[model samples]
Target chain A: MSADLQLGASFRDPSGFVFRKNGVLLRQVNRPYLESLKRLTDSGLYGELTEAGLLIPHTEVGIENAFSDEAVAVLKPERISTISYPYEWCFSQLKDAALTTLRIQSIAMKHGMSLKDASAYNIQFHHGGPVFIDTLSFEPYDESSPWKPYRQFCQHFLAPLVLMSFVDIRLSRLAASYIDGIPLDLASSLSSSHTRFKPGIGMHLHLHARMQAKNADAGTKKETRGGFGKNALLGLIDSLQSTIEGLKWKPEGTEWADYYSDTNYSDAAMIAKHKLVAEYLGAVSPAPNIVWDLGANNGEFSAVSTSMGFQTVAWDIDPAAVEKNYLQRRADKLMLPLVQDLTNPSPSIGWALRERDSLIERGPANAMLVLALIHHLAIGNNVPLLEIASFLARAGEWLVIEFVPKDDSQVQRLLASREDVFPDYTQEQFEASFQGRFTVIKKDSVPGTVRTLYLMKRRAS
Target chain B: MKKLNRALNIALACGCLLTICQSANAYIDAGSGSYLLQILFAGLLGGLYFAKTAFGNLKAAVVRRASMHKSDDSASHVR
Candidate 1:
C-alpha cells in the first residue's frame, strides 16, 4: 500500500493505524496490541457496545491487507459519512458526546476492559447520535490502576462542557485551538467564581488544575501509595457522569434561535418556499446523495432534503439554533445538525497541518442550500456578493439560493444597525454576481413576498 | 444509611490527610496531578457510589412491592 494513504490523525495511537487501500479504509493492528485486541473481543465488550450502537462495528479483514510488516491483523470499520470535530458541535452535542464516553468507559470496565484514551474526536455524530469510532481504544482493565484516560476525559469533554455551561457558549471554539483539549488550567482560569463553588467543577477543574501545577516538576517517582481499587474507578466514572448530566445549557437568548417565529414570511410564502426548495432539490439530475443546508436556522428547510431520502447536514452559526435543530432531528438517521461559523469555518490543524481536515476539504457537497442567507453575508458582514458566490461555488456543485432584496424586512433590519454602504446589494447585481460562477437553471418569485429563489448549477470551468 | 454516611465521612477525612504527602506517580505525563487527585478522593467517591447503589436498590424494591400490591387488589376484584 502507498504510504500516502495513511490517515494523518490515526498516527497518534501505537496499537493501530487506519489507512486506505484501493480506496477502502482499513485499520492495521500492530503486534503489540494483538493480545489486547483479543481481550476486547473475548471479553464480549465489542459485541455488547456495537449491539447497542455505542461503538462502530468492524470486520476482521485478511492479513494481506496490512499496511506494514508490523501489522498483526487488519480490519475494515464502518465509515462515518462526515467526520465533525468537537469544536463544530453545539452545547448539547458536546454534552451528549461526553456522557457517551463515560457510558462506554463504565460498560468497558464491566467486561474486564477499559478505554486507553478518551479524545472527543473518537466520537462522531453517526446515525443521528454520537457513536464511539475508535475500535482499538480498549485495553485489558487494570483494577489497581486509576483510569488512564481520566485527565484526557476532563480536558477533551469535561472542561469544554463546564466552560460552555458556566462561562460562554462561544468558548467551545477553544477546542479548535487546543486539539488535545482545552487545558484544565485555562478552563479553570476562565471559569466564573460560581463554578468554583459547584462540587464537580471545583474538584475536576479548579482543584485538578492546582494539583497539576503543584506537581508539574515532580519527576517520575513511583506512586508510593495503596492501589486505586476497582470500586474507586467505578465511582470516578459515576461522578463524571452525574456531573455532565447535571450541566445544562438552555437554547435561548440567541437572535437566530427564534428566526422562524420572528421572520416576516407569511404562512403561504413559507409553504411556497418549502415547496420550491423540494422541487428544486428533486430537479437535480442523477439526484444528490449529500445536501448541506447552510444558515439552517432550526433546520426548517433541511427537513425537505432529508424527507427526500438524501443525507442532509444542517449547519448554523448560532449554537441555540443548532441546538434546537439537533434536538428536533435527534432520531432522524438521515439528518445531522451541527454548529459552524461559515465566515471562519474549521481549518486544517495538527501534525503537518493535516491531522483533522478543514471544512472545505470535506466538501464540495453534491448540493448546497443558501436560503435567506445572502443578506447576512453581504450586508451584515460586508462580504461582497461576488466573494460569497465564489466561496459557495467552491463549497458545492449545485446551489439553491434565495436573494433577499434591499426592501425585504430582514435586509432592512440588518441595514437598521449600520450605514447602507452597499449600493451594489441589489437583486440584479446579486444575479449578475452569482451568474458568473453558476448558470441560472430556474427562478421563481414567492407569491406573498418580493424575495426571489433561484436554482443554479456551478458553471463548468 | 447512617453507616454508609459515616463510612463516607471517614473516607473523606483520610483522603484529606493523604494530601499532605504530596508525592505521587503515573505513566501518563500530562496529568500527574490527576493521579494524585484520584488517590485522594477514591475512598470518598467509592463510599458515595456504594450509598447511591444501595438507595437505588431500595427504591426499586419499594416500586416492585407497590406494583405487587396493586396486582393483588386487581386479582381480588376480578374474582
Candidate 2:
C-alpha cells in the first residue's frame, strides 16, 4: 500500500501483491482474498506441500507489525535470495520448476484446494526443490473457479517448456520480453510448423490459444458455463501432466554442461580447494544464509555453501556448462548450480525494473566465493581492478577471493590472445586496490598452485 | 530410485559438512557411500509409511493454522 515496491507487470493480479520492509519480504492479503487463504490452509493443503518442501513457508506476522494498517496480516518468509526468472533459468531448471508446479497442483487438488495461478515465477529453487513462493495463489475450489489461471498456466509454464523443447534453447529468454509469459498466440506462430499439430502442442499451444482468443473476444468476461467439476479439473491436470511428460529434451552434449568432468583440476586439487573454502567459511561468526559463487564453473566450489545449509547459486556463463551443472543438479537434486556470465550478467527488464530484480538488488550475498574470478574481469574483460574491488564491497559482508597473477598458467592463457597491457596487475597492486574497500583478514596460497586466496571483510557501515 | 535420490542428496549435503573428517579422495568415499545407501533404504521405508498414513497427523495442525486467519476469500470453505 506504500505505492513503492511496485515492479514489472505484477499489477495484473487482482488478488494481492508482494512487498518488503525492514529486510523481511511479505505479501499483503487484501480483504477479498481471505476465503481462499482460509480454504487452502484449513484443508491441510499448505501443510502437506510445506512438509514435502514443495512450497515456500510463511509465518503469520503478529497483528502489531508496522504494516498492520494495510495488510490483514503480514507474512515473513524464512529466507529470500536472488529471485531468478523463467528466462534466466536453463531449460532443465525451467522444466523442473514446471513439473514441480504441476506436482503441487495435483497435491492441492487431493486436499480440496487448487492453484489459482501457474506462473513459473512463483516457483523458486529452494533447498534442492522447486518451492512455490506466492502466498496469494490459493482459492477455494468450487469446480467453477475455472482454474482462473488456466490461460496463464499455458502462457507461463507449458508454452515456454514446449517451445524450449521443440524450437530453440534460447526461446526461454522470450519470457523477459513478454512478462505475462510469451503470448500463446505468438508462441503458436513462432513454433515450428510441424509442432502446430503435435497433439499436446496443437491442442494446448496452437488450438487452445486460438480458442481462448476467440472465447475472450466473444465478449464473455464472465466465468464460462462449462463448470469444470472436480472430475473435469482432475482430468485437466492429468491432461497437462501427459503433455509435459511427452515434451522432453534429452540433454544435448553442450560445451559447458560437460565442463566439470573436463576441468584441469586433479582429485587432490578439487578436494584441497574445496576444503580451503570450507575452512575459510568456518571462521565466520554467524552462519551466513546466502552465498554467491561468481564464476562458479560447474559449481564445485559453490557446493560448499549449500552443504552448510546456506542457499547458494553457482553461476557460470556457458549454457552448455550451466546445462551440465544443471544435469548434475537434477541427478543429485542440488540447489547451488546455475549459469551466469559474470562479465555480462542478467539485466533487469520487463514492464518496469520491478519485473526482475537487478543484480545489485538481488545481492549482496552474505558471503561470496570470488575465487579465480577477479583476473577474468580485470584482465580478460578489461575492467579496472579498483572497480572490481568496489563491486565486491557492495556484494557481500565477507569475501573469500582468489587473485591470480600474470605468471599463473591460467592467467597466461587468458592474456595469450590479448595484449599484455595490464601494467598494475601485480600482487602488491591487487592488495592496494582492494585494501581501500576490504580489510584483508587472512591470506593463504594453495599447496601446489601459485594462486593466492584471501578472506576479507567490507569496510564497516 | 526416487527415494534414493532424496536420501543421497541429504547424505551428500551432510557429507559435505563433514568433509573435514575424511581426506579428499578422487572418488566418492566408501564410508560415506555406505551411510548414504542405508539412508536410501530408510528413506524409502519412511516414504512408504507416509504414503499409506499421511493425512491424519497434519489435518488438525493445518486447521489450527488456518483458523488464525480472518480471510473472507473462501479460506474457510474447506471442511
Number of clashing pairs per prediction, in order: 0, 20
Question: Candidate 1's C-alpha lDDT?
Answer: 0.87
lDDT tens per residue, model 2, A1-461: 36335334355676666665654666667667777888778889989988988888888876555343545666676674567777767777877787788888889878877787788889887666578998788766655434556667778888888888888776776887787787766887788887754544555566555554444324332434343345545545544665677677765566545556765567887678888899888776577877888887777776677777667777777555566667776534435566566666667766656677667777888888898778889888899889999888887888999888888877888888989999999899999999999998889887578788899888986
Q: Candidate 1, which segments miss by more than 4 Å at Cα?
A: A219-221, A224-226, B1-29, B69-79
Q: Which residue runs of candidate 2 sit more than 4 Å off their true CA positions?
A: A1-14, A66-71, A212-216, A227-229, A250-253, A326-334, A349-352, A416-421, B1-79
Superposition-based RMSD of candidate 2 using all C-alpha atoms, in angstroms: 16.5
TM-score of 1: 0.93
lDDT over C-alpha atoms for residue B28 of model 1:
36
Docking outcome class, model 2: incorrect
| Model 2 Cα lDDT, one tens digit per residue, B1-79 | 3453334334434432332122122332212222222222233323433432344356666877777664644566863
- Compared with the true structure, all predictions reach lDDT values of 0.87, 0.69
On TM-score, the leading prediction is 1
For A1-461, candidate 1 gives per-residue lDDT tens digits of 56438889889899999998987889999999999999888889999999999999999999988888999999999988888999999999999999999999999999999999999999999989999999889998888778878889999999999989988899999999999998887898899877765666667777777777777665422582456888888888887887788799999998999999999999999999999999999998779988999999899999999999988999999999999999888878988998888989889999999899998988989999999999999998999999999999999999999999999999999989888999999988998999899999999997799899999999998
